[model samples]
Each structure stands twice: as structure tokens, then as C-alpha cells.
Target: MIKYIDSYDFFACQLDNQRCRLLALPWEDVLVAHILPRLPLMQLFDLQRVSKRFRALIRLFFTKRTTFELVGHHVPKVAFFSLVKDNNVLRKLLLESCSSWLTDNDLLPVVSRNPRLQTLDLSGCNGLTRHALVAVSLTCVHLRHLAVARCDFVDGPSLRSLADHCGELRSLDLSGCCRLTDATICYLAKKCVRLTFLSLAVNENITDESVEDVAKNCRGLEHLDLTCCLRVRDVSIRTVAEYCPKLQSLKVKHCHHVTESSLEPLRKRKVLIDVHPPPRRDRLSLAVDCGPYVNIQPLSARLLPSGLNADPLRAHMNGPAKVSDPWKNHPSFPPVMPHLQSPSHLLTLHPSCLVLALRCSSSPSLWSL
Candidate 1:
């Protein structure tokens, strides 16, 4: 029994020596390839707190990844700033809806550090100013996509700075930037020739001239939004159709002057166009005269005699009729009639009455005249 115990102790010592050799093996050579790729981003970030070796490995992993995103509301501001200040290899950074704590100073350090940034999205960052945008444009010369929508502080000078510096810019969103005008758009059109997607929705100051400038310069444009650009007319639509052959999608909602006729060219090219009808007031005014609704009585007792309707064209044959004429008392007749000799006379008639006049000339029996 004593000889058996000695043999068992010697076996246990050999097992302990094997365990020590396994633990002493180099983890960088064995574990990095097998473990790092499978780890979650949070886990990788936590690894940075383990030791200097771990921190170096995680930093190398992030540098190779080259993209980072942080939300201002969820992540602590100090942590985010520290990450931006530390990471030098990030190529894209998205700080969306970050108005809660993001400021110009925080943004300045980020752009200043990451001069290689190619895409930066600061959408809804209302706390940002013109200085931040100018700083980014100056620092990140390779920036291709930028979105500053709803940043009310962005104005003409900021856009001009971007146009001058970031010539490789491909996509830009200035939606809800109410201060933008034709001058700013013209500056962008002339400078950013590589722009492919642009949104200027809700900017009331843009006109056909700015659109024409874009058409003349930005040949590679694929998508455009001019929603609520009240000054934009059909001429701008025609200009885009004629020039931008690659245009795939266009939004012109609330652009009152853009009629269906003007959009035919774009449709023929298979471009997707989003257009909404004119307001109720304009539609009603064009189709019928609803203005005299208060004066309209029920037709039961208001109809003119058959004899009076029999010679409806007789009133037009003579020049302008007096207000005291028999037909003048008829509800169907307008309150006033101009001489019906020129084409302009048709303009004075209600649309319904105009159709009635035309029908009377072709077949008076249709109305039982």
C-alpha cells in the first residue's frame, strides 16, 4: 500500500509540470489567430484593459478594421472623446444624433486627429457650428460623403469651404438647412464635380439657376432631392433630364411649378420621380369655380327657361351683354361676361361654363336647350 502511494505522487508531479509548460507557451503566437477574430467588439475593447500586450493587440485589430461608430446618448462623452483622440487609423466615423453632448471642441479634435477620414456623418448634430464643418473640410481632404442635415448653423460659408477643400466629395445632404440659397448651391456645383447624391429638400431659396448649374457641372449625379424647393420650376426638371443621364431617383414633392408635362423626359429615361399634386386650393380653382359657393342655390327653382338656353351662343355673337339681360339672371351664367371674340375671353369663363359653351356649339340637344 505504501509503494502504490509513492507511484501516484510521482505521476501527479509530472501532470503539474505539463500544465505549467502549456501556460508558459506564447499566447501571441498561438491565441491571436484563433481567438481575436471570434471575439465581439465589446470583448475586444475590454481586452485593452488587461495588459500592455493586450492593449497593443486590440489597437492593431481596430486599426486594421478602420471604421468606428459611437452614439453620443449611449456612450459616455469622455470615453468617446478619448477613443477619437487615441485612434489615428479610423477611415470612417459616424456620430449620428449626437447633439446631446457633442460640441465644436470635441469635433475639432476628432477631425484634427483623423486626417485620413473618408466619410463623416454628423447628422442631427445641431450643436455643431460652421467652424466644425470648415475644420473637417480643411483636415479631411479625402472626405467623400458628409451629412449635416438639420444642422441649422451650417450656412453659405461653411458649404463654400467644403466645396473649395473637399473636391472628391461624392454625396452631401443639406436637407432642412433653410439658410442655403442659389449662391451656395452654385458654389458647390462649380467645385464638387464628382458629387453623385445631393439633397437640398426644404430649402425655399433654390431656383432653376442652381439646378442648371448642377446639370452643367455634375455629370455623374445619380440621385437628387429638391422637395419643398418652392422656387424650382419645370425648367429645372427639364434641365436635369437633358443633362443628367445617370439620374436614377428624383424627389420634387411640393414643387408647385413642376407639371407632369415637364417630367415626361425623365420618365422616358426610366428615372424614378416623386411628385405630389398641387394643393387643394389650386386644384379646386383650376377645375371649378368654388368661390361662388355661397351664392349657389339648389337647381330645382333656379333653372332658366328652355327658350333662354336654346340660344346660348346668341349672347356670345353679340358683344358684351348688359348685367340686366335675361341670361344674366340665370344661375348658369357668370356674374360678368367679357366680349367672346378673342381667346382671352375663354380665360374669363369658369371651366365648367367653358365646357358647356363648347358642347352647345357642337350639339345643343345634349343640354335639352
Candidate 2:
């Protein structure tokens, strides 16, 4: 009996050595991650092939390694936190750990194991909609910088959850989250009052009402990017001017409604056009007026009904309109202002004339593209 036991012990010792060698491989990061989890399930199925002591050591290392991975970075470190599919085994593990990291309401799991995590970059994690943000805000309380530019799941429930829970949030980048609307803006304003830097680029749903709410709540806001927010008319900028007193840098490109007057609030507006915006006295709708140099006929022609614009055109059939009527058969009309016929013709002179207009209504000093 003693001889048999010794033989078994020697075989177990050799098995432990082989398993350790696999774990020690340093050539691939991917290999370590793959093998770590399997150690648990592998022991349950194939431990007999290796010594009992070797199996116990592998399980111990697996637990320790996972804990290390979770708490590894805390400084300016960046990480990707995403939800796995329902069928994924890891997803089941994550779900089981769902204990509220920040709130008392839900027993959701908070990912606060890392004290040094600063930048939580979830740029393209499609599965992690608003449902997951609440937990993050609670767990990552030290998180000052966050980028969720394309996640669309952040609707009302999760957004409001953040404001109520994560009041420390400062900078947020929601550049391409198109589904977010006025309600989300209001929640952020009312909850996360510390938001200093924000980017709403290409968010098609945000309008003047949303801007007003943000201005009211986030008074400390400094830098704002309103690029591609098409509905942001003069009203939106006007609100920002009245509310966001500390604003410094702004991007209003493609905001056609922006005008020199709209820019009266900002100290320095970043305009991406070569030509200097027209004077305030000649300001258009909010920022684009047809005065300082804009032609009169095209302005009235399109803004006015075709019936009215046709009146002067039809009237000329009797005899003539005037030398200034560029469309008439006047002698000097074509050479003087060659492209001065229809509103479309005037717009051909300057493409910025589409129903779209943008301006830096934040304030005004020097403007550039």
C-alpha cells in the first residue's frame, strides 16, 4: 500500500508541473486571459490527469488573477466595460455579481473594485445601454472623464439615474448618441450640475428647449460643441448665452440660424468660415441676414410666396422692371451681378444659404472656422 501511494504522488507531481508551464507562457496576452477562466471548469472535468495539489494551485491562481485584473488600473487608466450576450458564460457570471455599487434601490453590482480608474471609455459598447450606466456611475465615483459618444441605450431612466447617483461627473462626450432628447438633457442639467465640458455633436434630437435646460442647470460649463445639431436655432444659442456664463470654447458649425447678434454673449466664438460674419446691424434671422451684402430679390423671392416674387417678374412683361432687375432683359444686368436671378442662384454664390445656418451666439470677439 505504501509503494502504490508513492507512485500516485509522483505522477500527481509531474502533472502539476505541466499545468504550471502552460500558465507561465509569456508570449501572448490573449492566451493568459483564455486559460485563466478555464482553470475552474477544467479542474471539474480533467483534474484526475494531474496531481491533486496541482489542481488546487491552479484554482487559487485563477481567483487571484481575476481579482488583480479587476483592480489593476486607477490613475489616468482607460477601460472598456461591456455586457456579454445572454448565452455567454461570462455574462452569467457578471449578472450574478450584480450588486448595487452605488444605489440602495436596486441590488445591481457596482464595478468599483478599481480605485484608480479615471477615464471610462465606452465609445462603441452597443450592449451597454443606459441599463448599465447607473451601476458605473455609482461604482466609479472617482470617474471625472467619460466618453460614450455612440451608445444609444441611454434614454430617460438611466440618464436620470446618473444625475441622482453620480453627481461628481464632470466631462461627457455624447457626440453620436442620436436617440437622446430633451428629457436626457434636463436630467443631466438637474442632476449633474458639475458638468464643465460637453460635446453634443450630431445629436439630431436636441433643440432649443434642451439647450435652455442645460444652461439653467450646468452653469459652470466651459467648452461646448454644438456641431451638427441642426435644430439649434437662435433660441438655443440665446439660452446658452443667458445661462452658461463661464463658456469659453464653442463650435457652432452648420448651425445656420446663428447670427452676429446670437454671438453677442460669447467672448470668443469658433466659426469655421473664411468670410467674416456680417455686422450685427445687418444680422439675418438669428445670425444670417441678407443686408450688409445679401441680395434683396433672392431673399424676398424664396422667403416670400412664388405669387409675390412672380408679381414683379410678371409685371415686367408690360414694358420693363428696371436696370437693377438682373433677370430682366436690361443691358447691364448680366455683367454686373451675373448670378443674381433666383434664390437658388444667390445660394449658388454662397452655399451656406441652405435653410441651415450656424453662429456662435455664446458671445463675440474674434470668429474663425
Report the number of the highest-TM-score candidate: 1
Model 2 / residue 266 / CA error / Å:
1.9
Q: Which sections of candidate 2 miss by over 4 Å?
A: 1-110, 267-369
Relative to the true structure, candidate 2 reaches a TM of: 0.46
TM-score of each: 0.63, 0.46
Writing each residue's lDDT as its tens digit, candidate 2 over 1-369 gives 112223334434434646654334542354335444543332323443466554554444433342222222231111112211111111112221121131222212324344334555555546454656777666666667777676676666776776776677788888888878888887788888898988888888888888888888899988788888888888778788778777876787887767667775464554233225564544322223332223233233465323334455444444444523424343322223333233333432321111112333444322111
| lDDT of the candidates, in the order given | 0.72, 0.54
Q: lDDT at 60 for candidate 1? A: 55
In candidate 1, which residue ranges exceed 4 Å CA deviation?
1-60, 71-73, 276-369
